[model samples]
Target: MTATVRPGLADEDLARLRARVTGPVLDPSTPTYDEVRRVWNGAVDKHPAVIVRCAEAPDVVEAIRFARRTGLPVAVRGGGHSIPGFSAIDGGLLIDLQPMKTIDVDPDQRLVTVGAGVVWAELDRATQEHGLAVTGGEVSDTGIAGLTLGGGFGWLKRTCGLACDNLLAAEVVTADGRVVGASDTENPDLLWALRGGGGNFGIVTRFTYRLHPVGPILYGGALVHPAQRTADALRFLREHASRVPDETSLMAALVVAPPAPEFPAALHGHPVVVLGAAYHGGLAEGEHALGFLREFAPPAVDLLGPIPYVALQQMVDAFTPRGLHYYVKSEWLADLPDGVVDALVDHHLARTSPLHQILLHQMGGAVSRVAPEKTAFTYRDAAFVVTVAGCWQPGDARGPHVEWARSAWRACLPGSAGGAYINHLDADEGANRIRAAYGAATYDRLIAVKAVWDPDNVFCGNHNIPPGHSGTRQR
Candidate 1:
């Protein structure tokens, strides 16, 4: 209850929020107000006195009724890749939703309804033009609605699962501004808190997945290794990422080497480890579940085979772009112990920046077959999830890369499988790691569905879910 950032709005509240938002109402004297309040993490330099570039769902219900008639503070930008700078907010009223571009494919019921500024490379190039696909975002311009409402997984997450387990319907905008519709028979507890329950309890804008038949080509790629065999490539990718096959998805990262002339100018600034396979199915069962990448060792560059599932979802789009300066710290392991590969090779060889990296992902098949109450992303037996990515670029000093990703995730939090990964946390890990990313009966049924749809918490900026009572967890 401490807003105080109103040195700007009120010329009849910007003429009644520009006569109820038709899109583009920005402030700080508009003229494109710093390019619609820049977002994709340049370590987020915010200044939101009001932005509102929303366009549909009645421009996010009149920008949540003009952020509750000017008490302001509300943020929500879809493809603005919110890595902790909760999509931009300083004295707030963001609601950008990147100009709500719509998508909508159907290909004889594979289904695909986008918009919420659809991103995962435009919903994997409009669901791969009917070859169809879904569990998206391994970076292809992330933001398939904040990675499927904060619980997405990539490379077909063990063959089709987490993207909030193929959502199916949404279109929120609640905090009293009304306009609802979640699915599986409408408002099923707001489709179980928009599947993964981030963005608190509203402002979804549109999303309705449930597609599949992946790859118009698969048996995927990458197998790197070199930084002095990165702990034997993380003990050969934690013993073949538990013997592959959920149509093989495996990941493993660790990175550094980017001097990009397609790499290997004697492994540029060193440290490698790559390992990225991706199978969806049959190339002789994805080459016998990736023949343990032809038995490990001797891999300076392997580049596996077949490709296109939209070129492996735009394969790390030139090693992550959008104004770089992302800080992550992730967890959830349930395995991969070699003191977590010597704490991720002693923090990527004690590096400070060669654009730092770590990402490990390879959780269980079909993401542990879904059922921890079927939604609100209950980790589902995490088998590996590591992150630690504290990249650094714009004028550096993000306090020594957020203290090197919090001292290498506190040396791998006693091999935690306790929590973390509400989209790789990191807005200062509050609310006790968001109640260890949903525990205690799915955070007390998302605090009674955020007290019946944002009981005045008014979508308290991303990663907050307060609305009191039921087993109580207010902060």
Candidate 2:
């Protein structure tokens, strides 16, 4: 069915839209509207005029058409995990892909075709059943679509590559209501854009990824040390992580220990530094390679050992549960300079909320071996990704939590690579930071591609790239 031609679509137009798709259409008055509109981030309180829980590509096409016809801005949701709440909009139309949760794994071809709504945990479980895997989100709850588009990183990244690197092809519903496929052979430029370009050109419905022989089990976990030893721990990590084998990946964090049963009650709620490591190789080799981390410092907690890869992926889920206010500031670092480490330790100690954390994810290996020009992700030489995540419960003052993250970010800027991981960036960082994320040349190329596929910028709800020939599309 074609869209109704009236502005501020009447109930009749909405009815027509509902008829075109085999999904539920939710409005403000609908009983489930509040629940459907809520995203993972509790801070987001947007109320879209309409929510279309799309079950298939045809439903997405109908939703986009309806938005265009009624002059409503469009927001697309997959897993509803966009940190900035990009999947929601105030008084606009939301195309939610949560119902499209299908996963098809081909063991012979080492390929997996996933619907946009499939989260990393679901994909991991399915793929692991066949002894196959792909580089997916560290937090299993993160959606495949948004993570891939923004250049995903995880424990397997050093051994394999970023999630985008494994993306072989995608099926997208473009702004003009045309269903298109992007691959090396078909619409190759669009495929290039999709490889770290954010959700600028279209709404992707499906992703096909190249899988690798990973593990049902691996040597991986974390070691926690007192906060006073943070400097020593970070310095040791910096020296050892750089020389580690390609199959080994590591991350360091300065955080307050959660009050969990695994942690000693005396240490709970105390500041601490953690060295998290994962080895994607044989158990013996992994143990030898990762053994030093466990012995580096006298830890208050030593949970490092052989663990199922799926278990490792979800280990941190308890700390990052839904319905908590989150604000993050991140930078890609070429080196972890002394000043940067000092700054991180200082800010971490000053954190107002125990839920906040300072994270440094080791990069390089296969990620850097891929030439910079091969994909839109420009920070190939970055040695690490630094993030200051400020989190608080409901009823907490927003000003202090946000300012803490910002101040920490400012302190680390001097040592930054002047670019950030696009997926880790916040909405308030604006266009200049977006340009910096992709670099000038790649950003220009993204804009050119945006002009070709979405000249009017109908898909501007993400880390948006405006069409080259037009001003920013009004949301």
Candidate 3:
């Protein structure tokens, strides 16, 4: 794969871009250039020729215009957490939105308006202050823009919908450098597309989300069992989770116990199967809902109880810290066949790295209640999302780890819905996978929307949806 030749920007062009916005325009020679180009994934090592740390919408507009005029591919960086490094580019323009982290919570209307740069942790803290929240990523460090656009899933998803489902409005800077708004009463078609249509259309500057009444503290934690008990644990989870109330969201994982103070020293670095349950309603009711799992079997560690929502959100942060070499392969399963369970257990036991984890997140609650046509997200009917993640330190060889995830994904594909979560996809998964992420009907509709908003495919760095043959490239 040869690298694309980046269109050169003349000195006058650089000066013009600098004069058009209030933000600082950094070139590769700048002292902070390398730091600005670094994304959360250590595997991506591209260096953009220019980086614009946008201060506001106007800066974003100027940056897009600069890219268009110079013919430099544009990459938008929100939380810099793009798993495949879509946020960074080689010798192109990187629109860095990290400086635009302003959040305004309107408790009166149960709405929270946040800048695209805001992460889930910041939003969770602010919304929890007023006893309200929207569905956000489990990892608090994930950016709101990328996660929501890719159809977010979190602990609150069963009780509430996905993050995109709660999105009421958005401010986007289109390909032609015009600021536009998308909402129910505004550009509703664009709003529908923005809900789950990756960044192919434009750059989102702000988002307004509808909040739901939730708790600052919820009964949620993990119950760990021995690795050999994975099949039994998963079988119990499958039955129990199917009948669990919407207020209860469940996730089962095969992970190695880290050497943290929370785990027993004897079990440190040991492989374990954990059933993590979170109930969003009253503490007593939550405990009642989670009682079966607590008493089902004796575990090495039992950490289920009333815990702060913020603490639960940050609980996995240690396992997924920034700069780790990571690769993820996921599939949406309509039903977990018995063979799939055996394969999952076998893969978990044969994992190349102890740090690797395989997760099964129970879907179908509020997530399924929404009509598929209502938004661009089409995977609402899935019963569970199976994610195979390979993680290792910097010096580790990438082949075995990546192969582990890919092989596991192949084994589980037989029981899948033939679709995937866009956010969890890897760079190697090509355009065909992108189309599969959005079903055939939704993919065609998204193409029409992309043609209307970005005919030239200016935002091609993401899980790109190119304008089809019907679209004429706009100057």
Instruction: State the C-alpha lDDT per candidate.
Output: 0.81, 0.89, 0.89
Candidate 1 vs candidate 2: the TM-score winner is 2
Candidate 2 matches the true fold with a TM-score of 0.97
| Residue 355's lDDT in candidate 2 | 90
Candidate 3: stretches off by over 4 Å? 1-7, 469-475
How much lDDT does candidate 2 score?
Answer: 0.89
Q: Candidate 3: lDDT of 213?
A: 90
lDDT of 3 by residue, 298-371 (tens): 98899999999988898788888788889999999988888899999999999999989999999989999988
How many clashes in each candidate? 1, 0, 0
User: Which residue pairs collide in model 3, if any?
Assistant: none
How does model 3 fare in lDDT? 0.89
> Per the 3 Å backbone cut-off, how many clashing residue pairs does candidate 1 have?
1
